[model samples]
Structure formats: structure tokens, C-alpha cells
Target chain A: MTVERSAPPTISEVAAEAGVGRATAARTLGGYGYVSPELRSRVLAAAERLGYRANALARSMSTGVSHTLGVIVADIGNPFFAGVVRGISDASRARGFDTIVLSTHESLDEEIAAMHVLIDKQVDGIVVASAALGPKTSAHIAEAWSRGIPVVLVDRAVPGLELDAVVIDNREAAREAVTALIAAGHRRVGFVWGPPIAGRPDRRRDLVDAAARNLWTDGERLRGYLDALDDAGLPFDADLVMVGEKTEERAIAEVERMLGLDDRVTALFCTETDAVTGALRAIRATGFRVPADVSLIGFDDSSWAAVMEPPLTMIEQPMLALGTRAAEVLLALIDGAPRSQPDGAFRHTLDTRLVERSSVAPPSA
Target chain B: MTVERSAPPTISEVAAEAGVGRATAARTLGGYGYVSPELRSRVLAAAERLGYRANALARSMSTGVSHTLGVIVADIGNPFFAGVVRGISDASRARGFDTIVLSTHESLDEEIAAMHVLIDKQVDGIVVASAALGPKTSAHIAEAWSRGIPVVLVDRAVPGLELDAVVIDNREAAREAVTALIAAGHRRVGFVWGPPIAGRPDRRRDLVDAAARNLWTDGERLRGYLDALDDAGLPFDADLVMVGEKTEERAIAEVERMLGLDDRVTALFCTETDAVTGALRAIRATGFRVPADVSLIGFDDSSWAAVMEPPLTMIEQPMLALGTRAAEVLLALIDGAPRSQPDGAFRHTLDTRLVERSSVAPPSA
Candidate 1:
């Protein structure tokens, strides 16, 4: 069957017909950034006459604005990314920008591929909840930056990337959680993390010093954990920490392994949404009640946490607010705002509050 | 600061360097459809020298092949959409197409705006879990088709659009749920739905004929609910059905109203994920233990449902399968495969099995 399709009128044609610069014509037609009322109407009138369209792609190529923000996140399976993306959606839409959501699934290669697509597609800017990046993997970000597309980091920031970022005070939050467990008379607090899984390249046994460079943001969290241990004069036990490899199933298996140990953990500190779910599932699988059997403190609050059997105690990072702030900063960059004013304001370390719920309690005698 | 950047090489440049047709170059670059070994190697070699990129966008405009599939969903907040999207992502990636995800948030205007973005972005095709389209609103779908972009519907098919769709037999699923409740000796069962909320179009006080055209697959589910009541020789109570408007707050309020009524409902059949959460929350708020105080059945089983206090008795739709089938059909359409064989296969209605859990029991005295 021969389906009838018309060749879409390009922006060059529209600009030529409007007798205006391609950028101005696109600004009016795409309904983004700024354009004068008089020129906007002229472009509209010409566009109507010529049956010109608001083709964001073609206009992006010509006028260098797509009005679409690229969002490359680390994990979509985790509900945490959904919340962050929702915030991006709200802010982007309110700013007349659409969002192109992609997930890295915790892989640097996938992240690079997605960035290529976004850069080639000509997005206005990007908000990256990036995965742990290895050294020498800076080409894609540099490529995007070279193309004048600003990158705003959210949730997890790459180590050496000098990009504006919105992140929770991970070390402090982790310390508070661990300290809370310690104050409750718990000496053996287990820690479950996303990456640096067993046999991974980044895993350095015996609690690597906070000064050391590595993949994954767990370094800060791990540092906080060590700080709490030192404050209470409790010896650090490396066996209590499990690397989840960014999957619920693997996390669950690791948690189960910890539970089966000769000296099992008394309290659990999960450092991500998937880790929390996996830990909870594993606890349930072991026929153990939360708080009663093993007190737990989870990072990144999700709706499931509130509705869990014994509502979970978690670190509630201001996710939506972080997204909003990141977008605002990104928008400013896109609008040609100076990188640093005289005051030099840059990194936004949003505070994470511990939501005290029924998941934690004093250890049983 | 001025950023020094050069325009990325286009596919035409790659094709020319490869000394092959655009189709052959695209086939090798996109990693889709089929390509011969020799031509693929030649294209790769040319891409390496010219730094020839896939660049879905430029390739889309020049060669009419944007290796990107647009996904416009209704509610990304709901886990249902997340599952469907995961399936879409999996299938699309495996088939060498990147997905661009968008949401309508249950608003027609937002839905229209999203479609405009997707269409203007020049996606290879679209899979829309469309919002309820009011009359005189078929223009955008028509516009996309006229532009040679095929759309496949998932979750629910828009009425009057002859687009290929993958949906569950919602009516049958609802009837089965209601029938199960009846068999459990519950006559005062309630139902909570998403759309057709107060003062909106398609708000028929009485159950409308099955032939009626409207949005959302709820109509079928509603019909099945009514059929179950009729089969059991019970009088239909309009009061038992509440319109949620697709938000947990509204659904919770409506559920609270049902609980506050002089003739309170003993059981609820929540028709969506948000409705289930709202109903569960309301039940908890009222200090009512599920299955003991009020037996409940929910649609679209979520992780929360599985971990609920008493778990939950709910309908588990093949959401991932629905997304997979939709993508498959869309790919076929994109490949210009024949619309039909001798059997005239088109609509794919996946099964919804009832997961029997502890949330349903005999009505209390």
C-alpha cells in the first residue's frame, strides 16, 4: 500500500519566507526563550501562509535550539529516578522545554551512547544523574560541552567533571544514619551499596580512605560510616558491607549472605532505593520482622518506604527541589548567564533529612 | 564564554564516504533491520575515518530514518507506566531503536503538546498511551500519519482511531474480579475508577452501552463489573462507583467518602494503581485491617501491593508484554510489513490474571 506523506517544510524555508533570521523565526515558532511581539507575529503570519510548522528538530539544526532538555539518568528501575525525572518534567514544561528521558542502567558505555543521541538531536541542555565514571571517559561530556550544551549533574556527580551539580550531603547523611543506630546501642550495622560489587575494578577492600579517588559516590557515604564507627570507638568490620551491583536481585542475595554469616548484622544501612527494596525483601525472606530482628535505615525515601510494613526510616533528599534548582541553573547557562558572578556560587549540596519511622529501634537484649 | 564547536558529520557524509546508498549506510549504522556483512564492514570503516556517527536526528531528516521511537505515556507517576516503559525500552533497544519517553499526566492539552513535540522531533514512530481525546481532536494523529510516522496504541486504544493496539481485556478482568468477590460472599463491593470524574464528558449516571466511544479502558472494566453484578442478581448502586480523576489525593477522598456513607461499602475494587494505593491508605487511616474489616481487590499489582500488610488480591495485567507487543507491531509498521495476512490480525489483548492473596475474604457480620 502506498501511503501518502508530505515532505515537511523546513525552517530555512520558513525563515526565508518570513524575511527574518532563522533564530528569531524559530524563537517565535518554537515558543521558547525570548522574541519580540512584532517579529513573532510576522513569523507567525508567514508560517501560516506557507504552512510552515514548529518542527523542533529542523529548527534545532538551523537556529540551534531544540526546546527539549535531555535527561540521562542512572537507574529508572529505581523509583528514585522517577521522582527526579518528574521534577525535571515539571520545571522543563513550565520553561517551555520538553524532556528526553534516557537511562544508563549503571553503565558508562550506555551513558556515552545516550549523550551522543542527545547532542546529535540538539537538546537545549542536559541533566545527568550519571553513573560512576572511570578515568579517561571524559570525551562525551567534553563533546556536549564543546557543542555549547550545558550539563547539569543531579543525584550522583562524576568525580572530575567541573559541572554545576545538585547533590545531597551524602557523608553527613550516612553519618547521621549510622550514628543513630549506634546511639540505639547497635554495634554491628550492616551497609548495602549499589556498585563496587565483588570482583569489580573499583572495589578496594579494607575501607579505602576518603582521600582516595574512585568510581561511585559511595565513597562519601562510606566515609561517613567510618566516621560514625570511629566516634563510637567501634572497630570497622569490612565483612558487614555488601556491594549490590545496582540490581535488586544481587542486592538481595548479598543481604541474604550477610544474614547467614556466623556473626550476623544487628542493624542495616541501605544506600539506595533498590538496596532498600532488596534488603526488605531479603529480611522478609529470612522470616524476620524489621526493627525487631534487624533495625534498618535506608537512603532515598520512596512511597513504598512509607507504606512498608513498619514504615521505613530513610534519608529524604530534597529530590524535587534539587531537580528544580538544577534546571534553573541549566536554564541560566543556556541563556548565556555568566558561569560565576563575583560571589562565585557553584556546588549546591542539598541537605538530606532523616525521616524517623518505625524501621529503627534499640537492639534487643 | 564562547564555546568552540563544529557541526557533527551527517549520515549523507557517511554514505558518500562508504560509497554506498543511504539505506545501506543507515542499515549498518542504526543496527536495525538487516544488512549484508561486506556493506556493513565498509560502512563501519567509513564511519571510523570520517568519524561518521549514527546521529538519529540528522539521519532522520536526510535519509528518512530516525532510529528513535517516541513513547507518550499518560502517567509516569504510576508504576504501571514504568513497567510498560521498561518493556518498551528493552524491546526498542534490542531492535536498535532508542525510546523518547513523555507523559500527559492525564490532561488532554499536555497530551497534545507532547504529541506536537514527538511529531516535530521526527521520531521514527510513536507508541501513545493516549489521554481521553475530546471530539475534533483527531488532527494531531492524522498529522503524524500524514507525515509518515506510524503510531501504535498501548494500555488503552483511543476510540475511533483504527491504530493497532495492545490492551488487556479490561472488562473481562473486572468481571472476573467482581465475580471472585461475589464467590467470597461479598455483595457490598465498591469500585473506584480514574476518568469520567465529576463534571467531565462521558459521565453517564447509568452504565452506558458497550458500543459507546470514549477514552480509557475503564469502560470495559466498568462493563465487566456491571455484568458480574447482573449475573449475581444484585441491584446496581451508582454510589458504589467513584471517579478518582487519576490522583491518589482525590481517590483517597472519594474512598473516605465511601467509608463515611450511611451504607458503607464492605469491599472495594480499585481499578488502577493510584486507586489501589488510595484505597489502601484510606483503609489504614480508618484503622481498618484489610480483608478483615473490608475485603479489597485491586488492578495492576505493584511492588507495594505484594508487600502490603496482608499483601493484596489484585488483577495482574501483562503490562510488559503489552509494551513489547506494541513495539513489535510498531517496528513491523515502520518496516512497512504487510498490515494483515489472511487472518487480519491487529488488536492484541493480553491476559490479566487474578493474583489471589490475603486481601479478600468473606464479608464481616
Candidate 2:
């Protein structure tokens, strides 16, 4: 049998049922201009009886406020993003706003498409964990800003775009993690995961040149690794660093290569979750033990990290707080709050915590 | 300085620029009906020059097809739901649809609000992992159905709703897990998670009564536990069961109590992610070694499960497949696919796999 449905009741019908002018009914139902309490009650009662649900699209078009927040994240499946989205959604809902989430899956084309869709849908604001590396790649985001749709960046920032961003001090966090490794007598430390630059960086200058072409976060992290090496008065060795596409398989291969080197890395500084997993898998396959043959430190403390064989020391980014603060900032902007910065960009950097577990130790003699 | 934004360009302006009639421009720009190739190119180029974006809301209102999907999950932060949402989003995007995700945080009031918001937004269809357990609690879903909006359930099913549902055979999966524990020579096994029923269930009949008030999935799982007990010619002992709010803290307290029992359980079956974490914490706190003191089985395999000291045996649900199939079915329903079931409710059950790792062993004599 076919499903039969009637057309939704309109404002005119509700007004007729309530014995009030259409304007009064529209004002009451649309929640716009003033209506007397008695007339408002009649209109609402009429709407209830007639089952009149306001057309959110039409209402948004008329008022120019959809009361909706759109989020464009790289991957909703990642635990980091999952936590952030939860924070954003919770805050948005508490503020009487609805949220529309779109995952880009780390594709620039998809990110562009998502931005256009959110704009066309007239979302009041957008919070993005951009996969974009430069201004040209983030043209859609800039376009959104020009269109008066507020955009807030999370996790990463783009150069040359003046907008609000919520992020952690990636450079400082990375330096501290790597510095701890160095202080533990790990002269030969391997860095895994970074921007996928073309070819390998054979020297320190090569890395410096590649930094300008990668994600701002990755560049900061690479610089932090360099800072630690420089502070220890150790010469940079290309063989001890793995910087490229961060797939687990690629990480495993690069780590194994480092392990097989004549001057093998005695410790590892993994910059991401997948990097840590890959390094552990490689160590296991190569007949090495964590914190024994080689000590390790990873970014992103996760549930699994606590339950690992010897537990894992990690740098925990405040993912939930990042999302919540971004929403708060964006909502304030939408509410006509003045920018605190002269250039119209507000950068909020949160602190990361280092949780020391069983994964770190002095390098084996 | 203040931001100045111009009003968006209109279709009429686009038509004028393209030197075509309003109808021709509308046909070309709206992607409806037909337009000549020459006129289509002109309208397209003119629209691009004007930087015009078709109002997706208006287009949806006129066409009655939003080309959007709305997803309401219990919690997007949960890895299971996160994976499911990614699968749904990927599948939806491949089919040229955008998805709007909302998290209810397991609150029925929020679920109802989310349903109303999605309906008001005029999404083409909805896929929900409903937090509502009964007909009364799910009136919004039924209302959406009555309003000619199609909805597909994921993860959980409502008892009286006649709608498509995608789920695993939770009962069989639970029974398989429990039966494995029994076969391993553990006579006293504790079931660590289920629906929140008031007061204590002192006998097996009370459990049967409580099943009617809980979630359908929980009821099935509880029945599966009972089936395993019956099959093994074992008496149902209320002391060996913990059924309530399924919170991590609650699970920890309950498991600790079980561990303190005079006739303590030799094995435990934890039904969810939080339950597993809580059980592990309780065992560690009580100084009870895994396998040696209490064998354990858990549901939902995760990254940490593989890296745990003794690892974890888990029942792995096809979470991603469940979401993909839900979207496929909902899209089909939206596209006018006929229901194959006589009752107009199509149910698809995916298989669950039992991954045996190092967590289970014969209980100590």
C-alpha cells in the first residue's frame, strides 16, 4: 500500500482557525515580531490543533539566521575528531542551535565541496579542521568569510587568512616530548609522521625548505624536533627521520629502515596516533621491545595507550575543549562581538599535557 | 573596522546576464526539465561570473528532494557510532547526498528535539540509532513516518515500529560468548551489563519481567545469557548478574561486588565498551589476575584490545556495514523500493565475529 500524506498546514489556515490576522499568526508562529499574549496563545493553540510546523528553510531565508552551526571535520571516525565534534554539538545544542556535521575524509576537493554546501545551506558559522595547507587550497573558506559566514579553524591554521582559530601549541608540545627523549640519553632519535613532501629531505636545510609547503602544524612540529636536536648539540641525520605520507604501512616500513641503520635510533618520537601504532608494530616485528631496546613517546593519549603492555607515555591534546571553545568564539562572532585583534584574527592556543607512563626510559647501553 | 557584505545575487540577474528567458535560466541553473546546450553553457558561465549559488533550501522546497540525509545517533563520540557515521557519510556522498549528523547523547528528550529539527529542515530521509525504547518514547519517529518521511533504524530496534532496521544478531553473539566461557569449564559466570531495571532481580522470572521494559537489544542479549545457562543445565543465579545504567562507574561497582562474593564468579561477560573498561579496572583494583583469577569476554573489538597486556577476546559487530546497509535501505525506500516483508518492516541482520585472543582460559581449580 502507498503511504498517503497531507500537505502541511500553513499560516493562513492557522490564522483562520484562530480568528486572527495572518500577520499576527505569522509573527507568533515564526517567532518574530510582537504579538499580544492573548493573540499569541490563540495562534499557538491553533497551530497545535492544525499541526503546523514552521518551514525552517523559509524562516531562515526571511530572518537570515538559520540557528544552525555546520562543522567540517577531516574524519569523524578518528577519535580526536570524534571527541571534538561531541564537544561542539553539546555546546551548540545548549545554546539552542542545531548542528550539521560533514566529514571531508582528508580530500581537498571534498573539503571545498563541503564548504560550498554549508554556505549554500546558509549555515551561520562553520568550524573546520582544515586539510588545507595554504591560502590557495583554502579559497572556499576565504569565500565563506567574504560572504559574511563566520569560519573558525580547529587543529590547524592557514597562513594569510585572517580568521579565528583554536589550536594547541604544537611546536612547544613537540619540543618538550622530544627534549625529554634527548635528556634520557637518546642521541639517535627517530621522528615519524609529517607532511607528505616530494622526495626525502637529505639534510636539515631540505626540511626547512619543505616546511613552507606543508601543513602549518606539521611545520611547527618539525621545527620543534629540530629545536631539540639543536639544543642537544647533535648533528641532524636524515636517516633517523621519517617524514612523508603517514599511513601505518609507510610508518612501519620507515621505522624498520631506521631500526636497521648502522647508527640506529635508540628512541622514537611519534607525532600522531597512527605513527605510534606503526612504530610499535615495527618494533614487534623486528624483535625489539618498547622502552627496552628503544624508548618511545607518542602524541595523543588514547584509551588503548593506558592498557598497552607497559602503558604509553603521551602528549594529550585537549580535543573536546578545542571544539567547545571554537563554537563559543564563533557564536560570539555571529552575535556581533568585536574582534580582539587588529587584523580580525583571533588565535587561541591551549596547553597540552604530557602523561608519563611506562613507555619512556634511558636508552639501552 | 566592520565587515561589509553585499546581498547575494538573484536568478533574475543571472538570466539577464545570460541573455535568456527566466524560465530557460531557471531550467539550466536548477538542473531540472531541460535547456539547450548553448543556453545551458551561457547560463552556467553567467552564473559563475556573478558568483551565484543556488539556494539549496529553496531548491529543496520546490523539488521536495533535499538531496540530504539526517543522522541522529546516541553519541558520535563512541567509536562504534563514529565508524558507523563515517560509513554512512561516505556512502551518502558517493550517491551525491550530503549528511547532517546530530548526537542525542542518549537523552530521549534530545532525540525528540533532533527529530523535529530534522523534519523541519526537510531532509530527504533519516537514519537514527534511536535512544527511544518503546512506542510511546518513539512517537516522533512514528510522526515522521506519518508525515511521509522515511526513517531507517540502526544498532537498536523499537518493538512496535514498522520500519527498516539494520542490526547484528545481538542475542546469538551474546550466547556464543557465554557458551564459550561455559565450555572452558567456568560454571560461575557473571553477566556484567544490560538495561536499567528498577530494584534487584532475585530470580530468573524477574529477569523475564524486566526484559519487557528495557531496550530490544538488551532484552535479546539477556535472553541469550539465559539460553546459555539453560543449555548448560545451570540454574540462573541473580547474584551472578548486574543489570542497570551501564555506566562505567556503575559497572566498576557491580563488578567489584561480584569479585567480593563468597561464591565469586570465575568468569565475566562484559557487554559493551565501557563495561569492558570498567571490568578491567575493577579486576586490577581487586588484585585479581585475568584468566588466573577470572576469565573474561567482552563486546566490541577496539585498537586497545589488540595491544592490551593479555589482549582481549571480543565480539566484533559489523558496525560500518550496519551503517552502510542502513543508508542503502533508506535511500532505496526514498527512491520507492518496495518492501519485501509482509508486515512492511524489513530487518537486516549482519553477522558478528568472535575474536579469541589471550583474555580467556580455563578457570583456576
The best candidate in terms of lDDT: 2
Residue A284 of model 1: what lDDT? 84
Q: Write the per-residue lDDT of candidate 2 for residues A1-365, one digit (tens) a residue.
A: 11134856667778888999987886787566789999999999888888786676666765668888999998888888988888888788889888888888888888888887787677899999997876768878877765567888988877666778899989899999999999988999998875577578687777755764656777888888889999899889887878668688888998999999988999999988888888988888898898999899999887668757677999999988998998999899899886447564568998999999998888888
Q: Model 1's chain B TM-score?
A: 0.79
Error of 2 at B177 (Å): 1.1
For each predicted model, how many residue pairs clash, with residues at least 3 apart or on different chains? 0, 0
Q: Residue A311 in candidate 2 has what lDDT?
A: 79
lDDT of 2 at A319: 89
Best by DockQ: 2
Off by over 4 Å in 2: A1-51, A208-214, A340-345, B1-53, B205-214, B340-345
Q: What is the lDDT of residue B215 in candidate 2?
A: 61
Pairs with steric clashes in candidate 1: none
